[model samples]
Target: MQINKDRDWEALYLANDTFWDHGEASPGLVDYL
Candidate 1:
């Protein structure tokens, strides 16, 4: 999959901000767990 290389996307993964608790868990896999 293609990922965004934009500053905002970088910030999220870098812990500058959160998009789903900063990678706590992917909701899609939560059901299997």
Candidate 2:
């Protein structure tokens, strides 16, 4: 099935649902130099 990614992201932002984000990255990721 095809889903509208932009619309879904807008909904999340409008609803203030930020559980998917954190101030820092996970262990496996390295900082951008």
**Which 10 consecutive positions of candidate 2 have the poorest summed lDDT?**
1-10
Model 2 RMSD to the real structure? 4.4
Error of 1 at 31 (Å): 0.8
Give the per-residue lDDT digits (tens) of candidate 1, residues 1-33.
345665577666586565446446776788789
In model 1, the Cα lDDT at residue 11 comes to: 61
- Model 1: which ten-residue window has the lowest total lDDT? 15-24
Q: Which segments of model 1 are wrong by more than 4 Å?
A: 1-21
By TM-score, how accurate is candidate 1?
0.27
lDDT agreement with native, every candidate: 0.62, 0.65
Per-residue lDDT over 1-33 for candidate 2, one digit per residue giving the tens place of the 0 to 100 score: 245565577777678765667767876676443
lDDT of 1 at 20: 49
TM for candidate 2 is: 0.33
